[model samples]
Target: MAHHIWRRSLAVAAGTAALTVGAATAASAHHCYKVDWNPNAYANHMSGNTAWMPLSSMGAMIISAPAPDGAGLPQCASYASVAVDHWMAETGATSEPLIHSRATVGSGAAYQGKTVKPFAYLQDSDYAILEEGLGMAIDQCMADQGA
Candidate 1:
């Protein structure tokens, strides 16, 4: 079974509680696809913006949450997570149905004097797609950072 992050640091909770996820260890990713790319997004720059990311794990990926106010974000809060999950399922990541029936303003992390909220509900069923999304976002960040 793939191990995903059952719990992670929610830096964007504004001192709120961090999030808790449930998944297998086989698919546990140390570096979240979306978070890895946008380190300073939630706290410093885009607090309420969402970012799509590609991942190192094949077609897997991630999506960032909406940036907060006064973060000078690039993207706005949208249902990007749903789209990304669909993309992952299309590519054969997992069969778990994408459940966007509820609107979730999930938690974030505090990195680099900034708070970043994570958007995508990355799970085993959708790991591939989110990871791929993380990869995409990371690629974008690399270009932006000239890395």
Candidate 2:
């Protein structure tokens, strides 16, 4: 399951017994210039924010890097947030069952459409690592199918 793989990856990155993975540490000091980035395979992956949806739909989820905390302000490079509000609505988890979850982003607000969001903050130096991680997972999944 994607959950198991993601959790294991998080655990490996965090170096913690708790499996609470977020983002890698930034190596630089000054804020790096903004970059237009996203995972190429989002259309085929899933996020806990979208647990409401079947694994089949996980890859269809598209999301942006974490924006700064304030409006129009993007969060630091190490912070990318995801939104599951759309996925939740699509899955009929409209009540407290999904609202109380931190895995889900937005309140069915902000972004418009269907998707699962898992907000992750990445180090400024490695803003795109998440995509690579996803790619690796996808490759592994594909390899599994081939086997």
Q: Pick the candidate with the highest lDDT.
A: 1
Q: Which stretches of candidate 2 lie over 4 Å from their true place?
A: 1-60, 63-126
Name the weakest run of 10 consecutive residues (lDDT summed) in model 1: 14-23
Per-residue CA lDDT of candidate 2, range 1-147, in tens?
786666545422322111112222211211121112244323222244433332212211211122221111111111121122322334343321211122434425424653334322123323243334333333343344432
lDDT scores in order: 0.31, 0.27
Positional deviation of residue 121's Cα in model 1 after best superposition, in angstroms: 9.4
Q: Model 1: C-alpha RMSD to truth?
A: 17.3
- The total number of steric clashes, by the backbone 3 Å criterion, in model 1 comes to 52
On a 0 to 100 scale, what is the lDDT of residue 4 in model 1? 16
